[model samples]
Target: MMVDVLYLTAAVCFIFALGGLSRAESAQRGNLCGIFGMAIACVAAYLSVNSADFWFILIAIVMGGGIGVFIARAVSMTALPQMVAGFHSLVGLAAVLISFSACFAPELFRISTPSGIKVLSLLEMGLGSTIGSVTFIGSLIAFLKLQGIYKGHSIPLPLNAFFASSICCLLFYFTVTESEEAFLLLTMISLLFGATLIMPVGGADMPVVVSMLNSYSGWATSGIGFTIGNHLLIITGALVGSSGAILSYIMCRGMNRSLWSVIFAPEQAKANDAVASGGTRAFKSGAPEDAAFILKNANSVIVVPGYGMATSKAQYALKELGDMLKKDGISVKYAIHPVAGRMPGHMNVLLAEADVRYDDVFELEEINRDFSSCDVAYVVGANDVVNPAAKNDPSCSIYGMPILEAEKAKIILFLKRSMGTGYAGIDNELFYASNTMVLLGDAKKTTEDIIKAMRE
Candidate 1:
């Protein structure tokens, strides 16, 4: 009765935590709620288990928590996406491990009934193992790609989908037949299928892929939860799965691509084609002094940042410039695209780290229209989000994705490294716009130079 009450309390906390996560103001509270709920759930689970398992569980908890803390403290903001992928892989692996343990010690897991092993328990073990195996391998691939160990291009195998389908069918057949050997075969094949599934995805769509993999991990956890008869795991897994699925759908819609295309279609070739076919177009270049003068005279400015800004660690300098402009009585705001960086809320996280004001930042839908009326649209290390190609070129992979309307601004100032294309590998037509001026250099240094010039 006490364990049941604790579980119910944990569930309530988790529900509130999710609600708190919906807005930035409550995000910290949400995190606290989640942590508290997890603590209670852990205690409940530990108490419910046998004395023989206590020491093992305690050791595992200490090791895992210490490692988690170390990683959380050491990881940089730019590598957060890779870290998230790695963590998802860990969750997958845990599910797989749980399934394996259940298989090896069905008595310990209470899976065997008076009439041999329960069919439902066997089904849960099969599904849990398959999904967990797939998620583990798939998340590893995603981590490698995000970490630059694997090239972000599709590696296609002929009849890959057909082979994956055949594997699934075999796995189902073996599960129904209760063949242990076939179950092992199913696990191996699922791992291969997972690898193949993610190998075809390009880097540009990694955000969606990560979210999809997160959903897979959640479902795998839920399967394991059912196998273990753990209510807390079931509830938490459902929440995570639903949230990840929603995020994936939102990201897919933001890119103006279907979820099917994101998963199956190769995008690297399309991006390369867009770049190759786009002929060189001339554009005006300017120095930091020139940009300073333009910015000083402007009545309003909208700053747009991208993955490059994160890579260059320029958010601090960028915030300084915005603060300077604000002191001069100019209207300054940040225009954040839905898919601006490597992960969801990447730009926001960076800016927040730099102590940028919450009210000054606005999402794509909120600040997109204001760009046209603004005196200057200052782009820092962003390309595709401001690229007119997304709007004008139907053949481009990123076509039909809504942009920041930077081209609509009276004057556009772009701080970039070179004429190099973005992650999408498409030429930015906004660079060639008559009202745009390019400031080529490292984003942090350039912003600092502009600030110095403004003071001079």
Candidate 2:
């Protein structure tokens, strides 16, 4: 009865945690709720286990907890996506390990009958193992791409769909036959399938990939939960799976691409046909003083931040600039693209870290129309999100994707290091817009210079 009550409490906490995460204001509370819930669930699971398993579980907990703490403290915000991928891989691997252990000791797990293994138990084991294997390798590949270990380009494989389907069929057959050799074969093939699935995806779509892998990891965990007959794990896994799926869908819609296009037809969406034409366009350049002068006189300003801001660690400098502009009676607002930076909500996270006011920040849909009435649109290290090509040029890779409408502003000031293309390897036409001027330098240094000029 006590254990059941604890499980129910943990479930409630997990739901609250997810709710809190829906908005930035409640994100911290959501984290706290999740942590407390997990703690309660862990205690309940530990208490339910036999005395013989206690020491092993204790050692595992201490080691895992220590490693988690160290990684959380050491990892920088820029590497958060990679870290998340790595963690998902670990979760998948855990499911695989547990499935194997249960297979070796069916009596201990209560899955074995006097005659043979229960058919339902075998089915659960097979599904859990297959999903876990795929998730483990898929997440590893995602981590490699995010970490720059693997080139973030699609690797074409002939008959990829046929091979994947065949593998699934074989895995199902092996599960029914209860063949140990076939189980090993299924694991290897599933791993290969996972790698192939992610290898074709480009870097620009990594946010969606990360979220999709997270969903896989959750489903894998739920499969293991079924095998172990643990209701808490089931509930937690379902929550994670559903939430991850929703996030992935949201990201896909934000990029104006279907989920199918993101996964299977990524090459079509990311092909760069406009690269040759980009070099012929003319653009105006400006200095820090010019930017400062324009910004000082502006009646309203909208600051757009992207991955470059994160790379340069310039959120604090940006906040300072915004504060300065606000003091001059200029209405200042921040416009955040959903898929900005390397991950979803990446810009918001960085700005929040620098203590930027939440009320001052607005998403693309909210602040997009406001750009036309604004005096200046200040772009910091962002490229694709503010590019007019997304809306105007059908030949462009990012065509039809909704943009921040930075071009609609009376004046556009871009802070960049060079005229390089963005993650999709396509040039931004916004750089050549008649009303736009580029301030070429390090984003942090440039922002600091502008701030200093304002003070002077």
Candidate 3:
């Protein structure tokens, strides 16, 4: 009875945590609420378990917690996406392993009958194992891509759909037959399906892919929850699954991509790279001093950030620059593209860390038109999000994607490592625009130099 109350409390805390996490202002509180809720849930779970398992569970928790803390401290903001993917994979693997334990010891889960394991249990375990296996391998592949291990390249298997369907059918058949072989076969084939599903997807859709995999992991957990008769697990899993799915859809819309197109027709995304291999395009270059001069003289400035900013960890210096300009009677605003970085809200996280004022930041739609009337658009370590090709090149993959109209500003000061294309592997026409001046260097170094120039 006490356990029930604790579970209920944990569930309520989770609800509040999700609500808090939706907005940046309450994000820290949300994290705390989540941590508190999990602690309550863990204590209740420990109490419910047998004495024999107490030491084992405690040891496992300590080891896992130690590893998690170490990784959280070591990983940079730029690598957060891959790290998230890796963590999601662990959830999936946990689900699969739990399903195995239940299958081998059906009596422990109270699903075994006089003749054999309950048919319903078999079905639940089958579904759980299948989804879990897929989520595990799929997330690993996503992590690899986000880590630049594969450069977003996908392995093409023309018969992927047919093979995946066939495996599912076989899995269902084996589950109905109540064969012990189902678990192993399900894991093996689903892993293959996982690889095939993600391999065809281009790098452009990785954010959505990560969200979808998260959803898969959640559903896998829910299926196992049903098998184990854990109501709290079911509730938590449903929350994660539904929320992840919604987030995925939202991100797809942000990229102007249909969810179906991103999932079933990765060829469209791959097509973006075909014309990206052209020779070096002519573009004008500028030093930090040139950018500093334009920034000082500008009446209004819009800052656009991307993955490069995260790579250089330039958010602190960037905020300093914004503060300086704002104090000099210049209107300083931040423009964020939804798909600007490797994951959703990547730029916002960095900027927030640097203590940028919330009121000064605006989304692509909010600040895009303002660029036309602006004095200077300061693009820091961003490329595709502000690319004019999305608007001008109809034949390109990202043609329909909405972009920040930094190109429309009176002057464009673009800072990046080089003149190369972004992850989408397409040239940004904004680079060669008449008003644009590309500043080539480390983003943090360039921004610091610009700050020094401004102070002089």
Candidate achieving the largest TM-score = 1
lDDT of 1 by residue, 1-456 (tens): 899899988998999899997788998898899899989998887777736677788898999999999999999998999999999999988888888888777887788778666788888888898889889999999999999898854656555676578677876776577677877777888888788889888777888988999899889989998988878778888988988898888888888888888877776446576545466778999999999999999999999998889889999999999999999999999999888887788899999999999999999999988987999999998888888888888887788998889998999999998887877777787888889999999999999999999999
Clashes in model 2: which pairs? Answer: none
List candidate 3 stretches off by more than 4 Å.
269-272
Per-residue alpha-carbon lDDT of candidate 2 for residues 370-433, written as tens digits (9 for 90 to 100): 9999999999998888888888888777888888999999999999988877766777878888
Total backbone clashes of model 2?
A: 0
Q: What is the C-alpha lDDT of each candidate?
A: 0.86, 0.85, 0.85
Candidate 3, residues 185-303, lDDT tens digits: the string is: 77788888887788767766788998899888889979998988887788888989998898898788887888877877777644666767678878899888889999999999999
Better of 1 and 2 by TM-score: 1
Q: Which ten residues in a row have the lowest lDDT in candidate 2?
A: 269-278
Candidate 2 residues lying further than 4 Å off, grouped into runs, are: 23-26, 157-159, 273-278
Q: Please give the ranking of all candidate structures by TM-score, highest first, separated by commas.
A: 1, 2, 3
Best by lDDT: 1
